[model samples]
Target: MGRWEPDARGRLLRAALELFAEHGYEATTTAQIADRAGLTKTTLFRLFADKREIVFQGQGELLALVTRGVDEALNDASAWDRMVNGVLVLSGAHAHEHRTTGRILDPILARSPELNERAVFKRSAITSALEGSLIGHGIDRWQAGALADLGIRAYYSGYDLWVAVDDSSTLADHVLAQITVLRGAAAQALEAAAPQPHPAGVRSADG
Candidate 1:
């Protein structure tokens, strides 16, 4: 693709965000977004299915990147390691790309329940893709589903924290850190749930 081709999509995305911020998501029309971008409605439609699609178009690419990462991981890697690797790959692919767009998009999503629902669906799609990849690598289906959920949760948490901070670490580093935190929490919960012996001198409250 030409340099200008990428610019066209960026322009439309930015224009749509601005209009949504100024008016409202429901009030902002595709024609206005195209006009703001200095492109025709036809050109806008060529790049996106609709206004919602413009906001979510990158999700498909992210899913593909994560899936490729899972597929190419070392054969001996554990399921959790493979999931983390996929998230790291996704972070690398989108680290610097979405900061500005996210600043604009987050508030818009919060304001509209429709947008929020769509965002949840997009996240679910990513988790589903990751689960499928894990299953293909020979992991049990149920365990793979749980690991995928964890990976996606870590990804979004890390992404939010990374974009909000002015840290020197890369997005992948933040993602790994989030995954570590989640793992620690899970371990602690498991430990707490394990049965423990009562002290010899201790009496039960009921006794």
Candidate 2:
């Protein structure tokens, strides 16, 4: 068996996880992770260009899943429900479910001056991808854009709170309830904006 080389990628992932959890992200090293994985540094480099890349591979899959969910929502769900569901799906479920990988990436990125500068740019990439998916949902362009922004903000706010509180409430449960509130607010706003009807005789299509 190749031992270190047979499953280099799996070894890298496990090594990175253990090292990250034990020594924290920034303190951990690619060489150390490679060593722990029973591989050479060159093999590690061949498998992964940099340490940060290891933490981010999952995001590509998740973003794809989110896009698929958004696209599927176009056919059947109400505009509001689709947007809401998209929001919920993007956030994922537990801290471990959607957050651990990002969480690991976040602190590492934050502490590095170079990575910090690029963080917003990376986030914008995801936001744009999501915006495209929202537009594909048959929502008006402006409303879809606003819904995407608002949904992410609300979903993340709830997500962060849930994480901070350490409560039993699931992320899905929390986000679904929040969607009802957002729907209510959006409905109220639309209702308030509807033109008031004139008395029957006073009404005219245009004149």
Candidate 3:
């Protein structure tokens, strides 16, 4: 193998995914991934902290993008509006480029509990970051948290749909559509849970 290589990080990530798929996450080793990429173990470690990190590359960038989007929204914007802006920011930047890898990653994470846990942790971290940003903008904590959860769910669900479905829409389009769906669902749930008024002539059994 050459001492210098182009796209080493990309190579390592693809190699790791392939090995994890073939032999399973726990069964695959860093050295095997490195070898599969035609790179050295030292090169792999230089690119990633460990075998697990390879699968989660770009998490930091996404979190930063999410924070930026929410923070930059108009001061008077509603929490849900700010969340939609955040989803648009991140998904527009990353979704198209990541579609191919996302397709491969979804099933691999589904098969591996450890990898899926890490994926969930990364998402939770993004949600927390978004909530903090909303609070910084003077939004109420409860509303901030709820909007954060909904925002993250919308972004990811949109990404999943983008990867699974053959569509002409961009990731931001998919994410925005999902946000609309989630908002409608939340509305229905609240309406269903609301107490209905009793008829004027109705009497309780206790009464």
Best by TM-score: 3
- Give the poorly placed runs of model 1, Cα more than 4 Å off: 1-6, 198-207
The worst-scoring run of ten residues by lDDT in candidate 3 lies at: 90-99
Clashes by residue pair, model 3? none
Sorting all predicted structures by lDDT, with the top scorer first, yields: 3, 1, 2
Q: So what's the TM-score on candidate 1?
A: 0.90
On lDDT, who's better, 2 or 3?
3
lDDT of 3 at 111: 89
Against the reference, the lDDT scores of all candidates come to 0.86, 0.68, 0.86
TM-score of each: 0.90, 0.66, 0.91
What is the C-alpha lDDT profile of model 1 across 1-207, one tens digit per residue?
A: 332455887788888899999998999999999888888899889889899887787788888988998987888999988998888888888656576677778889989988898999999999999999999999999999989998999989988887787757677888899999999998999899997878999877767
- Superposed by TM-score, candidate 2 places the C-alpha of residue 17 at a distance from the truth, in angstroms, of 5.1
Give the runs in model 3 whose Cα sits over 4 Å from its true position.
203-207
Task: Give the per-residue lDDT digits (tens) of candidate 2, residues 101-171.
Answer: 54554565555665565556555655666677878766788877777666765665666555555446777
Clashes in model 2: which pairs? none
* Model 3 TM-score on a 0 to 1 scale: 0.91
